[model samples]
Structure formats: structure tokens, C-alpha cells
Target: MAEALANPELRPRLEAFDSYPDATPPPLAATEELTIPGPHGPVPVRIYWPGGTPSEPRQGLVWLHGGAFRFGDLDMQEADWTARNLADRAGAVVVSVDYRLAVEGVTYPIPLDDVVASMHWARQNTADLGISSISLGGASAGANLAAGAALRLRDEDDWKPEHLILVYPSMHVDLPEPSKSLQLALTEMLPAMRLPPEMFHSMRENYLGALISNPPAYAMPGLADLDGLPPTLVLNAEYDDLRASGEAFSASLAAAGVDVEQVLVRGVLHGFLNLSTSFEPVDDAVNRIAGRLRAAGQNP
Candidate 1:
């Protein structure tokens, strides 16, 4: 498996994620870098305020970036670009969490604790931040943490997020079987672009450690009860393997009577949101996300 991942044949496809074109993020009214107290330690965060003076209180979002749990940071396009676009378009304040990665000795509950702490900070300071409501969301592994944090908040604090914006998340410990058409579509993808089942298995091992066999309740939220999670917007990449997990989780959310919107973004691969803002799908997804955040503030 390691050999396959290291194959020179896959280099170009792999490099695309790091080398993809990026444009300057739209200007925000202000961007602040701060640290909030966390269970593990202080968690760093970058906050992006909307560019305009708003007539009403804005929505607040705690956003996390994705790297299969161990590889992303606040500066990544998934974090910076996504936050900037959402703040600008949604007219909301976006707090991008620099949660601890699941690496070295860090594992379950550490990153989760960071996300939970960030949410608490955002919620407690909502008034000062000029936001009326708060939502929790992320992409891929970050999405997993967002969902886990939401469940933790629900059970431990009896608090509920205003909404969830999961972008191409991997929610299941075991990747669900893809539909026949999806399998065929995935076959056309480059080797490095596809997230094989083994990759998910390895990620689970790294993130969950010895508990992967019987992970805790919120570690893999797709397999947990979803009774009262907030209205969720799940965006799945049309050609990504994790689409199965996203689709299944959305179905479970609906089954549990939670409001859920599942959108399969067409003709895109995994981590599409991390690409340049010029990408049409990325633009469209940001618009949809901002629209949702705006609605949450207006109605809440």
C-alpha cells in the first residue's frame, strides 16, 4: 500500500492538491489571529469578519480544514479561502480553528477537544463578535471532527450548533460500498486522487489508535445516533470515494429526523473546496454555503 501511494506514476495527481492555482482571498473587514483555551492547551484560530457593515447581527461559523486528520492547517485554501469566501458572501464572521492534528501522540479527543473549545469561545463571544448564531463545519477529517464536536457538545453541554456544513466528509469507520455507477466513475479517476478503503482504514488507525475496532460514540459520528444534530448541509464530491460515507451519513441524519441537505457536486474530485476560488464548483459550493449561513442568522 505504501509503495502504491509512493508510485511516481501518481506524483502529478498528488501534486495537484498542493500546486493547484490559488488567488488572493477576497478582502474581509478584518482578520484576526488569536488563541483560545482548550482542554489540551491553547488552540490557535483565525477569524475573518465580513467585508461590509451589516444592518443585522451576522452568523458565526467555526471552520476546520482537512488533511485526513493529520495534515492541514489554518493557512490552507480549505481554511483560509473557504473562510474568506463564506465571510464575504454569507456576511458572517468565520472562525477557522487550528485544531491539533492526529499525529505523534495526539489522537482522538485531542483534536476534538480543540474544536469543542473553539466553539465554546465563539459561542461565548458571539455578542462581541456581532454574530447572532453559530454553526460548526469542516471538510474531510475536519468534518469528522466537527460532527464529533457537535455530538460532544450535545451530550456534555446540552448545546446544539445552529447548522453543520460538511464538505466531502468521511464519516464512517468503514467506508460504505459505492453504488455501481460510482464505482465505474471512480475507476476513471487517477490513482492518487482516489481514496481507497485502505487509506480510510489507515486514517482510522492513526486517529482512533487502539480504539479503531470499537471507537467511541462520536469518533465516527456517522455510526452514532443523530437525533438532534443541527440542520446539515453535506457537499459530496461527485467522483470521490468518500461520497459513499457522506451519502450514508446524510441518510442517517434524515432517518433520525434531523434536517439534512445532501448535494453531490458534479465533475469534481475529493478536496475540491481546497482548489482555487476560480473553480466553478468551488464558487458554487461557497455560494451555497454562504446562503445557508445567511439563512441561519436571519431565521435564528
Candidate 2:
């Protein structure tokens, strides 16, 4: 763990966000900008279709951006790049959603409502989008939305996604029992990563609103009944706090007879996917997701 932290390449890029330098955005073919009406207000979405082969029907992916549910938008450079990469790599149309943040909206059901609306919108426009099947996925808080969306879709709408992908998702508000190695890793990495404990508590409080009496399984996927969720791929950083949540979610899925794949990427931290230069694990995880999509598309 010490050696991993001491790696110069990893050290600098991890701290890059502190200074927040701007870099060139990845080139995408074309983006259709539009607003989908939600209960709260207009929810913005950017639809990205890869350049080439418009003749064939494609797979669709509804991408939720991550910012701990407090600070992300569809227009961010990282989100745009992720959409473009997923579209190009998976040969799928990507609809990136700009859902209401918890800080602004302050509620339990609001974010989940937006996610469900986004999914419905994507499904309704499948003909125009030229896709037969759809998947839901995201990184961090986005993955939280994906998990919640899947549950809501199954229970409320009786619809199932073709696939679900979670990248270092925060599925539980509670921390897991710490193993010795995990403890060591967290001790070294948490301080270095500069994740404030108070900030997380604030985010959770904002998302839960006043309805904190009972922990809803919808808010925490690990607590939910995982009987009918789609086949899932859960990716986690070995040193991330969310690692336990991902593992627990995977175990729940397996116990409920759901097909599940969980991958732990070593020597990576939370939000690594956003750091393109420093995070080689993101590329590998994306490739795996694309392969899974291809197989699902072929079989479905």
C-alpha cells in the first residue's frame, strides 16, 4: 500500500482536482440537446450517438453522472468523455442525464424520481434512438441512481433493465467491518485522498431529507430485496470506502439468484474513473462493460 501511494504518477493526478486544471475534452460525433419534463422541473439530457453504422439498431445506455449527488452535471468534461467512450466502445447510444442534485432539491425520492423519468424517456424513444435493449449505469453517485432506478423499475413499473453497471457505487450509508489489510489501506489512502467525513454525512442527510426513521432498501441497494434485478457488473477500487458496499451488493444479488460479476481494481481510489490520465483501471473496466453489453445485445 505504501508503494502504491508513493508512485509519482498516481500521486500527482490524484491531487490534480485540488488545483482543477482544464484540459481538452474528448471529441464526440454529435450530441442532441433536449429537456425532458420531470415532476420537479425540466431535466436536461445530452444524447450521444457514435459516428458510423446508423443502419442497424443499437443498444441504449442511460448514464448518470457522479458527484456524491451534490456537484455533477451532464456538461462536465469527465461525463462527456465517459458518454463518448461508452457510445464508441459499446456501440450503444448514450443518454447522459442531468438530474437534480441533493443539495438543491433536498429529498429521498426526488433523485430516484428523476432517474426513473430518464429511464422511461429513453425507453419511450427507443424507436427514434434505434435501440432494442437498454442498460443503466454510472460512477459513484451515478451508480447509486442506477441501483435505485433498477429497484424502482422492478417494483413499481415491473420492467427490468438488460444490464446494470456500477462503478465504485456507494450502495450503503454504513461502513463495513474493516479487515486488517483494508484498514491499513484506508488509513493510508483516506488521508491522502482528502475525503472529509463530515461532507459525506452532509450529503447523506441531504438525500434522506426528513424521512430518516426507516432505512429504505431503495436508498441502500444492499438492504433491498434483490430478487429480480438484471445481470450486474459491479466494479470497485480496492482502497475505496465503497468497496464493501459493492461486495455486499454483489453477495445479495448472488443470494437472490441474480447473475453478478464483481471486480476489484487494485491500487485505485474512489472517483478514479474521472481521472483519465492517472487511472488505467477505468479503461479496463469500461472494456469489460462494453464486452458485457455486446454479449447481452447478441443474446437478447
Candidate 3:
């Protein structure tokens, strides 16, 4: 970890996250709140429609919020900003899903079920929302759910997203044995943030339920067969702990004949996308995602 701290490039990125500020006021008008039915119960969703006018049916995105599955909701400033930005920039109706968190239910299929249900609801109401196609994306564990939901949609419902965007996603359950660079980065940031490994393990256990010998491929989409999946864009932080898994997942998608693009931002860490006001990289990443969504299905 000392080596990671010594690297000038890594120190600044960690500092940026440590110093991130609250999000700015929303620039676009959001739709009235709505509740989508979930398997366990009703999951709240906030649909953001920029300018509140459906000139033409636009693309749609069902966005999940990040929290290691134990924290986060639709109301978080970052989540709200993401929804607004995606809607205005991508010209898509962005539905921010408030799936049940781990602390409340703490089990497998619970979070997954909520996301699937939300997508179904989104698809069913696409006409009202003026959306033509649907896409999935999220940050961190939210990204995990997004990937898993896409796989489920494909396998069970034959639903294919026009695109899949993951922002520093937690794609693998078990952290790869730390590489030299990873170890260095952790050493520098962990002490400052005081994030414990056991806490992360507990979060995993809470989301996965009982410790099964082998979790399903959908649980870890990086482990799943990526063939026939949608075109993907993965934005990763150069110094994030999850960088390796994100990279590996991109490789898997490419190997499966899926179109995949990756943007590795130097001097950044996980969850940076949420700090749009403070982090320039966050807005840059969001714009890039919106551009991709705008271009999806246009040429090919």
C-alpha cells in the first residue's frame, strides 16, 4: 500500500474523493414520484423527464443506486443528478429505482427481484414515458444489480437492453487477491477512510444471503456467459479497488463478441461519478455515457 501512496498519480485521485462536495441543484424538471410494484413489496421510483414534454418516443434507462447493496436510495443527490443528467443528455427517460437495501431485507433475489420488476414496469409504461427502448446502468453494487438484471431479462424474458453502462461496478464477489498496485492504493486510502475489510465482507454476505459454495453467474455477471449481451460501456477509476474486475468484465464482454468500450480515468476512485459538482471526471463520465446512449443502434 505504501507504494500506491507514493505514486503521485494515485494520491490526488484519492484526495479528490475524500474532498468531494454535495451535488448542485437539479437543472431539469423531474416528474411526479411513482411507485413500481416489486415482488416483496412496492419499490419507489422517481422518473425524471427533462422539460416534461414527450416530443417523440425516446430511449429509456432504468438506473440503480450504489451502496454496496446495504445503503443508498433514489433520493441521494448523486442518484438524482445521474437521473437528471441521463435524461437531459441522453434524451432518454431515466427511471431511478429504489430497490430494497440489504440492511432491511438482506438476502439474495430480493434486490434482484426488485430491479427486474422495475424494468418490467418501465417497459410496460414506456409509451406514457415516451421511451422507445430501455437500457440499464448504475454505480458500484447498483451496477452489479444492473448487470444481473440484464442477464435475467435476456435469459428469462428475452429482453435485451440497447446498452449497458457500469460506473466503477462491483462485478466480482470475491476481491481478487490484491495486486501490488491494488495493495498500494488500499494502504493509502483505507487508512484515511478507515474502511474495514470485514464490513465489506458483511455487506457481501448480507446481499448474497447464506454463503453458498458457488454463486450463480448472474450474481456475478463477470462470471456469466457474455455472448449476445448488449453493447457495453464501462467507466473505471484508475486507482479504484474494483478496477481489475471492471476491466476483466469488459474483456469478457469483448471476448463474447459484444461491443465494449472502456474509459479509465486516472486520479479517481470508486463512487466518483456521484460527486459531479466536485469531480470533473464525474460529469465527463456522465456525458460520455449519454453520448453512447445517443449513438446506440444508430449505425448498426
Candidate 4:
């Protein structure tokens, strides 16, 4: 993949970023592929049930993958591998949602609606699935969707996630600018990591369509009132433009009196979650997510 980029010298680092030391996914007790009813149609999902017998109601996680709202699938490492890892470590049922991407006639609410529906389905079936609770989480654009759905669930239905996990998310339509030190470091180290505002504007426009002129708060979650939301974990990549948004959103969550933990991973670019578990930060982030989910289930 790096061969196609302007900097061929980056091939080694980029390859390492993409490859896991062990390509095989961690073992799971079981995995089921099925469809959940959605407003638009059926939303496909993969459920990763952890290995071993449960002593109590296991935790559940409703997860989504990032692709700028137009790309990605349940098969991506961020969705499948992460779900498997989380399930194994947290001993939780990880529901990886194949929510509708924003493409062609599909737009903002359509994709977000799919996620909300999936969450409702997961929560309603917790007992049948032998899980006590479920949390909502995602990476990048998927994180944007997760946050938007969290607000919708809170306002529209007075429902809230047990926990929220956001990884390298770009939450705002108007993103916060990177600090001078960050900008300098990115330019000096990985200039390709710099994302122009126009790119983000275009990504939002592509996702929002006609709603681009006046997107609702749920459509651009950073614009929403974040009060009454559940505890959250925000992981931002060290060298990504979207780190600004993650940092800003973390601050917003804290100001809203939400329990929020923000971690800025060093020496990495965005979407590192898609990389192999051999990457120390990626492994650590997944472990942290697992530990939190496990604790939430136990406490609840």
C-alpha cells in the first residue's frame, strides 16, 4: 500500500502498522452472522461470543468501524479483529454492526438510524444473549456515528450507553485546529498525515447531502448538548489531524460532567486501531477498553 504513496521510504513503517505479529484473530467461543431489522432494511452484524462459560451476565459491546462514512465493512480489522480481541479480553459479547455507509442515495440519518436500531436490538436481547449490558463505540467516522446515536438514544428515547469508546474520531464539522507543536511535529515527521479542512468538509458533505447546509446536532455530534451521557474513553492518535477533534470532544464531555478518559497515543497516525495488535498502543487501547467494559458489567 505504501508503494502507491509518494513516500516509498515509509513502506516499512506503514507495513508494520498494518500487519499483526500474528495474523490470526484471537480465538472466540462462537461467532454468529445475522441481520437485524433496520429502518431502511436489514442491518448486517457479526456477534463475537467469548470463550469459556459465563459465571454471570456478560458485558456486551455494540461496535462500528470507521471509513469516512462511505467506506469500510464488518470485515475490516477495526471491526472484526477488534471485536474478537475485545470479546476475548473483556469476556463480552461484541456486536460488530455493518451499518449502512453514507453513499449514493444513503445519507446521514439513514446510517445513524441503522446503528440506533442495532443498539436497541442488542439491548433488548441482552437477556436472551446472556449479557447484562451493552455499550456503544466506534473508530473515526464510525465514532461520529456512535456519538450521534448516543445523543439520539438519550434525547429521543431517554436511553444511554453503559459506556462509550471513541478512537481517533472526527466529531465536528468544523474541527479544532492542531496546536503549533503538533502541526510542526506532523509536518516534520509524517507530512502526509496532515488533513486539509476541505477534505473534512467534503466528507461531511458527502455524508449529510442536502442536510449539509444545516446539519442537526445529532448529525454533527460535537454540536450537540453532551450532558447526561455515559462515561467515555477517547483515544486519539498522536499524528492525525482529527486528534484535535478528539481532544476537544473529550474536554466537552468533561465540561458536561461526564466521566471521560482521554489518551493521546504517541508515535502513530490515525486509524491505528486497524493495525496489528503487535503495535503496543493499539494493544493497550484494546485492553483498556476491555477492562472498562468488564468493570462496567460487573458493577452494573
Candidate 5:
């Protein structure tokens, strides 16, 4: 992203996520851009509704996009496509959240706060929003935020999400082994899949100052308490360095006796979720998520 910003030719295309990229899988019946008040400012959100008569009381989802807490937007191709597809597949109203990014050296808790606030806002207006059951889905950095919010909600005696949908979540900021890092660094040369081990260090710094200070475990889900959380569905990519951590997190959740299911997609790397066109695995992952949400029912 830094390099993209440096080159004048690519800056606009990189910054403007709305008209940036294209991916066609399924079309949404309706799309809406709306906002809710936040501690920082008005948080922008995009809503997707499936085609057909709305269900008696719509099932809803609160989605967070992944950009390492600094790279994504509501209009980004992956975010938009996932929202639309989930709306169509799950028969639920999907709300894609555009929370405050931790750019310019912003500290921890802000992004999580924004997400939790958005959930509160949505829940408060559930009747107005025409939704009964609510679930949470997020990818990469968004997954981190979703899990953190789930923890917060559980601790506060707030309404827990019916389920958690996480895709390639960056759960731990720890450095990988030299060989693993080398493999990740080499894989970036592959077409369309981008995951650099070094970037994780920088992202951790950018999001939460220095690791020496040791921020709360919520900043990194792998270090947090996993008990009393919502049922979680964690999806990981085979070649992703973060896969190890995500899998460990899942195991921890299971050990804690929390309901958890994890799927490891072979022959793919981090950011695989965004390569639906180039990769066939994306559809299977999406379908699995939708099916899980559908089975979660209107109230669970």
C-alpha cells in the first residue's frame, strides 16, 4: 500500500476502492450506503439485501472488511462482493461496516470501539432495520475486530452474535520462524495472492504501537480469553503464515468448550478470499459460510 501511494499513477486507483476492481459472482437485490454515529464521527456502512419479497423479519449480519486496519473500505471489491453474496446466499440483510482505520498512528481500541458501537446502533434499531437474528462476519483484519467485539459483548452481558464468520484472521502479531517467513516472502511473487510476513510486523506496529508495550489481548485474539464467546467458524488458507495462529485459536476455543469449527483451504495463500475470480475455493468458502448462517436461524 505504501508503494501504491508513492507512485502517482497508481495512487488514485489504490485509494478509491469504489471504482477500483470488479468481481461478479452473484448480484444483490438492493444496496444502500448509510451511516451511524460513532465516538470518532459518522461511521459509513453499506447494506445488501437479497432479491425477492423480504422475509417476515429479515435476518441481519454485521460485516467488517479486512485491510490490516489500514487498507480497506466499504467500497472495496472484496467487501462489496462478500456482502452481496452473503445477502443472496443467506437470505439476510448484510451491513458492511466502514469503521475508522488506524492510520496516522492511531492507537488500539478505536476500530474495535467503532465496530461494537455499530453493532449497538444496529441492535437498537432492530425493528427499524427489519431484522431479527444478527450475526458477525469479517475477513483478515476485520476478523480480528469481530472476535474482539464478540469478547467485549460477552464480557459486558450484551447480546452475543448468533455466530462468528472469520476468514484468514490475523490473530497473532508474533514473528514467524525464519523459514516460514521466507516462504511467505517468496509467495508474494505468485499471481494475485499477496501475503508478506514482514507486513504483519509493520501492521502490528501501525495498529498498536510497539509490541514491547503489550496491548490488551483483544488487540490480538490468539492471546485473549476464548470462553463464553459465540459459536465461531474460522476459515484459513493453506499457505498463510497466519494460518497456524488461527488454527491454534480455534483449538483454544474448542478446549475452552466453546462451539467452534475451522476449515483449512489447501493450495491457497492469505487474501485468497479476494481472488474469487482467479480461485475456485472462494465460492466453496462463501457457500459454507452462508449455509452456516442460514442454519443459525432467525434467533439462536
Candidate 6:
């Protein structure tokens, strides 16, 4: 993925997809595009309020989109369709952050900073925004940011979240011990692995940028202090390279005495959440995500 990010030939293709994700996403009760003030500049954000009318103030979730930290934007299906569907299904307000990606000038902390800022914004304005409970959620790269932001909130700011939602997330800078020893044909082409090793390498470099050699724990929550984290739901894909890492993080969360729920969606690959049209399981996954998030919010 990193190589693709740097490949001049693939840049245009990536931009085109970012500009035109699933153009015909199902119409939702409500959608709004607005900007949130950020340290660098105004950050664009999309909001979805369940049922188009909050009958009453509802729970809030600050969402982040995944594109290996180098591709995608608000128009991407992960941010648009996912947010809309989750909002309505959970009957809560969903706010999707168009965080700055790790492009030429942007780097690690920048993307993670935007995520934390958005969370702060959502929490502070919940009342006026008709939001009651506040949860944090994301997919893939977005999920990494959500986790990173949560750790930052807890450690640096003495703040904490009530619920967390992660999907096929990359939680560690390094692969699990078991994955390190395994070798496959043509890179193995294992039953549950979709991406090539080179892709993961490139994507990781693209995300961290050239400056940072030793990425801090906040850059990868798997390395962070996990004690005191709130309840979390981890959704892992059956055939994703990061599945083991995500599950490991979930295990760590449980070990820390935090309530955690982990589930593996069978017969699905990473990025399935945005491929609902091609994969039937995606619909079921989204529904499960909505239910998990709603349950988290309704808890005291």
C-alpha cells in the first residue's frame, strides 16, 4: 500500500476513488458536511443524525475512516456509507472525521492529532448537538487512529471513553510472534491473508513518514498502556493480515480487566465493510457494529 501511495502511476487512481466512492450510497435520513477547527486549519467533517431527527438527544460516536493513513477522504465509502448506516441503526449521532492523511508533508502525529481533536469537539458539543452518550469507533487505519486517540486521551489528558469500536485494525507496528515465523507460497497466499508483504511495508512507511524512526506507543496502541480503557468491541476479518494483531489487542484489553468483545467474521477479507455490494457479509457486519455500539452507549 505504501508503494502504491508513492507510485506516481497509482496516485491518480487513488484520488479518483477518493473523489467517487460508491456514488449511489443508500439515502439516509440526514447528512451534513461541516468543518471543525483544528491546529493546522479547519478540518472537514461529516455528521449523520439517526432518523433525521433525534426525537431526543441521542448517543454520539466520533468516527474515523481508513485508507492506510495515506488515501481516502470524506467521500470514501468507509466514512460516508458506514457512518450513515451506523447512525440510523444505532439511533445515535455519528461524526466522521476527515483527518489529515500521511501524504508528502503530513506525518504520524498529525493524523492522530486530528482524531483526538474531533473527539474533544464531539464531547464538548454533545448537548447542543443532541448527543447523550459518547463512543469512539473506526475501521482499519481509522480504527488504529481511534485507539491511538483513546490512549492519548487517557494518559496525557486524564480523559477516557465509555465505549470503543474497532474493525480489522492494525494495532501493532510489528506483526505477532506466530506471524513472524510463518512463510507461504508466492508469499504463501494464505487462506486468510489478502495483502502482500510489500504492500504492508509500503503502507507502514507512508503512514509514519520518513522522520520518525522510533514511533511512540501512541502511534500504535498495541504498545500503549491499556489499563483503565473502557469496554471495547473488536471485529476481525477472517482473512486479514492484521487479524491476529487485532485479536491480540483484544486479549490484552481483557487481560487489563476491561470489558471486551471480539468476533471474527468468517469468509470475509479486510476492507469488507466498504465492499457491501460485493460481499453479503458486510451488511451483517455493519448491523453487528451498530448493535455493539448501541449497547455500549445504553450502558450506565
In candidate 6, stretches whose alpha carbon ends up further than 4 angstroms from where it belongs are 1-27, 52-55, 178-193, 210-212
Q: Could you give candidate 3's per-residue lDDT for residues 128-242 as a string of tens digits? A: 8877788899898999999999999999998788899888887777765555765676665645444356766776777887743477888778779988888888988766767
RMSD of each: 3.7, 3.1, 3.2, 2.4, 6.2, 6.3
As for TM-score, the candidate ahead, 3 or 5, is 3
When summed lDDT is taken over every stretch of 10 residues in candidate 1, the lowest stretch is 9-18
In candidate 4 the C-alpha lDDT for residue 5 amounts to 47
CA lDDT of every candidate: 0.86, 0.79, 0.79, 0.87, 0.77, 0.77
Model 4 worst lDDT run, 10 consecutive residues: 1-10
lDDT (Cα, tens digit) per residue for candidate 5, span 1-300: 666568675454334321322435576677888889988888888888777887387788999989888988977766887887788888888889999898886668889989988888888877877787788979989999999898888888556888998898877778434346436543543322345557767788888876436868878877888888888899987666677677777888999888899997755556765664334566688888888788775433
Assess every candidate by TM-score: 0.92, 0.89, 0.88, 0.93, 0.84, 0.84
Model 1's lDDT to the true fold?
0.86
Give one digit per residue, the lDDT tens place, for model 6 in 1-300: 555457675454333323433456555677888898877788889888676554666778888889998988887778888887787678878899999989877888899989888988887898767877788989999999999999988987887776889999988777664344222211433332356667777777778776336768788888887998878989987656778778789988988998889887765557766664334467778888888767755566
Per-residue lDDT tens digits of candidate 2, residues 151-249? 999999999889998988888777566456666767766354645667766667778777655658888776788998999999888777667777777
Weakest lDDT window of 10 consecutive positions for candidate 3? 188-197
Better by TM-score, candidate 6 or 4: 4
lDDT (Cα, tens digit) per residue for candidate 4, span 88-129? 999999999999988878898999999999998997898878
Stretches of candidate 4 exceeding 4 Å from the true structure: 1-13, 298-300
The pairs that clash in candidate 3 are 1-184
lDDT of 1 at 54: 81
Name the candidate, 3 or 4, with the larger TM-score value. Answer: 4
Q: What does the lDDT read for residue 231 in candidate 1?
A: 92
